[model samples]
Target: MTAVTAPEEVARIQGRVVRVLALGQVLGGVAFGATVSLGALLAADISGQESLSGFATASVTLGAALCAIPLARLAAARGRRTALTLGNLFALVGIAIVVTAAALRVFPLLLAGVVLIGAGNAGNLQSRFAATDLAAGERRGRDLGTVVWATTVGGVLGPLLLTPGEALGRLVGMPPLTGAYLFSIVAQAAALILYLVALRPDPLLLAQRISRDAAGGAAPPVDADRPLAARYAMFAVAASHVVMASVMAMTPVHLQHLAHAGHGGAAGANEAVTLLVGTTIALHVLGMYGLSPVFGWLADRWGRVAVVLLGQGVLACALLLATFGSDVQGIVIVALFLLGLGWSAATVAGAALLTESTPVDLRPRRQGIGDTLMTSSAAVGAVLAGVVLGQWGYGALALVALVLVALTTVLSPLARR
Candidate 1:
């Protein structure tokens, strides 16, 4: 094993690793943005039912949930490089399949492809953890936050590309909505290259080596195979995601409904609705990743559980706003932004805490499990959001979800110690 004992060398390598991972996030996140923005429209069109539209996003989250453990295991066995590459590979295949599914108008095939794309999402999610592989105690949250922030650029750009992607598709005789995913293909490919070439010294492997060295060359303990603090981190992370996903998965639909209602349900207003929804989602994506650094710094300066509690507070604010103002376009837009920001605060802090709570040897495995739980729970929420939105309305859905936010808020304080 490569000896990575020196603090300076580890920090230097960490800088490089973070840079690579950040850039990878920029590229990889595009796929998710493209899929999320277009996936719902495509699902409704393909299935001839609006209720199934949210399932499109749900599939992506489900895919990520499924890939979490396996990719974590790969990181445990080979390294982060291999696991990320495999993730990109799945995304690449998924992109092609989605386009094909679009051509055939096959909803199931489209879901299958979206699910594979989730593998890439899982990799992107895991990259935040990779940032901590060589992170110093104080700067762990900062380093992780930097990588998280990089996604803002790609995510915003991905949705913006919807117009041109469709143009490109029209020029090439491709299916209508499938063209935007072409950008996803290129972005993911570039990310795959970045990971394979730039992420040198495999941050996880290096951290493992350094941990062994610190422990006199003996493997670290698992602490009775229990990671209590990790459980709190997972709950915080999962809780934040569930609320975020439930609302976000349906935001576009809600906006579209408002647009149609205003225009008397005229089909001619589809373009206007698209523009509004796209802009709202773009701003929301910005909220998700834009202020990560500030939160990360705060988590380091303040306390992890404190930041988590603050996140719950923000989420509560968002849920209430979304509940009462569902019909108002401007209020919904602001609420979506707040929703993204709250998720960012909770997840960023929750992740840093997860890293701090576990032993080095047990980090990867436990993190994977945490992510699996996080994504899985969010997937369920996303699915339920669809049903609730279909049967009741957006306000009712948001009101119903307040219970989740309250639960997380009440329990997170107990883990402060």
Candidate 2:
């Protein structure tokens, strides 16, 4: 008879494996965060059309929506390696298109390029799934959380690059902001290389194979038709993401209008706007990604539904705070901070919930559909934010956000139990 491995031995090996996967994910997160946070800003500079910025932003999210499901299916049918490699290739192609668009100064072509880049964003979203595959029952949250924290590092660096990127863009015969795209290319390429070299055996496949071997070749698939609570949890999680994305995307513009209206100050309008936008962006990012590990750990212990409800409540309060003090600088900062934190809670918890609620074969399908909804909804919200903010002013936008929060709050209790 074959010798049985000790539980401790198995755990040690798994830990090592999980670390490798997390490290790769962290690198990927940095690239993903850096590109997304600044894409709109860059688009504005290149196109010289402020309104088109939203379209550029939408293209990336739309690309994610359009391709996330297809990519998931590809992963399910082929394997993780093929899907990720394909995503990297698509990103590369997108970058090339973006570079060409910048050189040619074509607005529509630039939007098209961003769409291709967005397809890559879909792949990055699925990276969380790979991290989860290496984790044990409740530890899924913690693993996913670590990867998000990695994103904060890259995200912090992305905006700071604008100073130097502008100079580089001038040298390259493109606009000042175009240099950031070059950095994106380098960062994404590095991520692609790391994924190809380090992510071996494919965690999803490994998890499945291990379970099968452990079960003597007869283990049931993870999903096998989940319970009603699981389905509800999925929707709640998805809803949280929708709210977070929709609101967060419009914040920078909100800061601009508030500043222009003599709310922030008169002397340093531009600088003040930059600081507000950058600071809020940082906080929003921190809130959305920083506490992922803790929430992930909590999901493992407290139950996904409970965390999901708590997150929704937190987000509701954030919306209310933002609405009441839409014009105050300090208040807006606090509100955005809370908003980011709330998003982080819901996003991490929701992801864990989704993973737990569904089985292996169904993972790609469920995750793809759920994320597609989340990204697409956010895209719609972004486009709407542009129009609404222009028409009704920031106060009205805050009120709208309040309505969303209320809607989520009403559903929170129903979601929990």
Candidate 3:
């Protein structure tokens, strides 16, 4: 007879797993936060074209899209430890390449490095799933949300580090915009080590083993019809992501443009612009991850479809504010914050829905595919957003993005309870 794990033992193991994953989120968030906040600015400076700035965000999302499936496959075959560590290792190398690219003034190389950083970002995305591996259905959202919330720490700190990171870089004669990434390298390396040493028993593998033991080495019964339900959840995740990416990716560029209209002052225009962008992005990121637990709880208590709709509603409000009020910095800041908050609610709820909707046997792979879809779609949205912003203006871009949120809402009928 297979020896079953005691319920208490399983709970204890899950608690430890959540704690470890939370720490990893904090570290991963910092690395990506710094890179993401500056990627567009760096690309613009290196390419000398504001129109190309959006490509930086696009590359990062594309890179994440590329890594998502492979990382999920690895987690299925090997374990979460291996997959996450590999992702962090990729980020570390990418950070170094980005610093080198900055010094060499190579736009292509910068993109290449940013893409690898995106691979690391994929690992961060997967970590939330990892948190759910041993979670009970009732607490799944809460556990996942806790890990997501942990990211608020590093994410907020990363953007705020712009000035200090820059000063440190200048002390070593590094390029103007490349200094923040120097700190990124250390953060990624630390995350790599954390996953390597701390994640014992491998949460996904352990969960699979427990399932087998419970089933006495036989396949667990699954509802043949419900696997298809994952499609709606995936769509919810993808729609929310693309909408958020389209607007958020261009905010920095928009702020930089505004700084020249007497907002940056007569002296130190670049510094003023950097600080302003940094603060705004920090707040935006704060909105993205800070209140995730609340969204997660709402997902658990309020029904998955309802919270997803709520997110779309919040997104619509944000788009309206941004569309009509792009000229006002305060309004723009508030809009960006709303943008992040909407993403948090939709993504957290949608992900939780995806978890319960799919068959256990196919969950990892399907979830990976979902992430790929989400990121790739966002990549397209971000790329197009750049064209729109470059040719027209920020307000036009927001108005265009609003249409997507409305469509997602209109299609809400597709998602079932």
Kindly provide the TM-score of model 2 when superposed on the true structure, using C-alpha atoms: 0.87
Off by over 4 Å in 2: 1-13, 42-52, 217-224, 258-276, 412-417
Tell me model 1's lDDT, rounded to 2 decimals.
0.87
For candidate 3, the lDDT comes to: 0.87
How big is the positional error of residue 106 in model 3, measured in Å on the Cα after superposition?
1.0
Residue 397 displacement (Å), model 3: 0.8
Error of 3 at 137 (Å): 0.4
- Residue 56, model 3, lDDT: 92
Estimate the TM-score of every prediction.
0.96, 0.87, 0.96
Question: Each prediction's Cα lDDT score?
Answer: 0.87, 0.68, 0.87
lDDT tens per residue, model 1, 1-417: 558687777778999999999999999778778888888888888998888888888898899999999999999888899999999999999889999999999989999998998877887788999998789879999999999999999988888888778889889999977788888989999999989999898999888877767766433332233366678889989989989988998888888889988999777677767678778888889989999988999999997888888888888899899999998999999998999899999999999999988877898898999999988888888888889999999999889878988898878755755
